[model samples]
Target: MLLITCPECGARPETEFVCGGETHITRPGPFAEVPADVWAGYLFHQANPRGKLRERWRHQAGCGLWFNLVRDTVTHEITSVYRMGDPKPEIA
Candidate 1:
């Protein structure tokens, strides 16, 4: 089982959090001016790399705060977790 640590609630089971998908995806400019293709890509596309990937998650059952994590997709290992506005933690 994946053990996810909620920054506010301390260590907890992964079941307590809900993943919000890849992190660091910047939304395109004003929606009214963005082209259809660009908008579609922005909404549906995400990088699905096999190695290290960044993701966002909400501590649904705990503090309900959103946070970020740097994880290894293949090994299901989370290298680091940090607050939403804080700089991402670097893996040593």
Candidate 2:
């Protein structure tokens, strides 16, 4: 299992956290103006890239804070973890 490090807490087991799916998802738009297809895409579509990807994760069994993590999908190597509002870091 992965040993994810929380910004607030120290390194913890992957079982203590929960993956919240892909990060940086842009909302389609104002609900009243967005078309049905676009809205559906925003709600259902996700980029399951095979290489490096940014994802949202929560420390469910610990401090219970949300954060962003950059990890390699193929290798499961986490390069960095940052807070929710921080800009995404450049990872080679």
Candidate 3:
């Protein structure tokens, strides 16, 4: 099983956390001002890179804190785990 380390609670079972999808996505704009297509793209578009990716995860079964993680999709290896507001780390 994959192991995930929670920033607030330390290492825990993967089941304790829920993947919150890709991070650093900004909202399109004021609702009515944004074209429907742009808004739709913002809501639905997600990059599914084959290699390393940055994502958000919430430790629901532990401290209930959300954090960011850089992981490899191919091998399921996590490179870094950090608090939500912190800048994403530079992975080698």
Measured by lDDT, the strongest candidate is 2
- The candidate, 1 or 2, that scores higher on lDDT is 2
Model 2 Cα displacement at 40 (Å)? Answer: 1.6
Order the candidates by lDDT, highest first — what do you get? 2, 3, 1
Candidate 3 regions with alpha-carbon error over 4 angstroms: none
Full candidate order by TM-score, most accurate first: 3, 1, 2
User: Which candidate gets the maximum TM-score versus the true structure?
Assistant: 3
What C-alpha lDDT do the candidate models reach, one value each? 0.89, 0.92, 0.90
lDDT of 2 at 18: 95
Over the stretch 5-90, how does candidate 1's per-residue lDDT look in tens digits? 88888889999999999998889998889999999898888889998999999999888999999989999999899888888766
User: Measured by TM-score, how close is model 3 to the native structure?
Assistant: 0.93
Give candidate 1 regions above 4 Å deviation: 90-92
Q: How well is each residue in 1-92 modelled by candidate 2, as lDDT tens digits? A: 78999999989999999999989888877789999999888878888888889999999999999999999999999999999999998856
Worst 10 residues of 3 by lDDT: 83-92
Model 2: residues with Cα > 4 Å off, grouped in runs: none
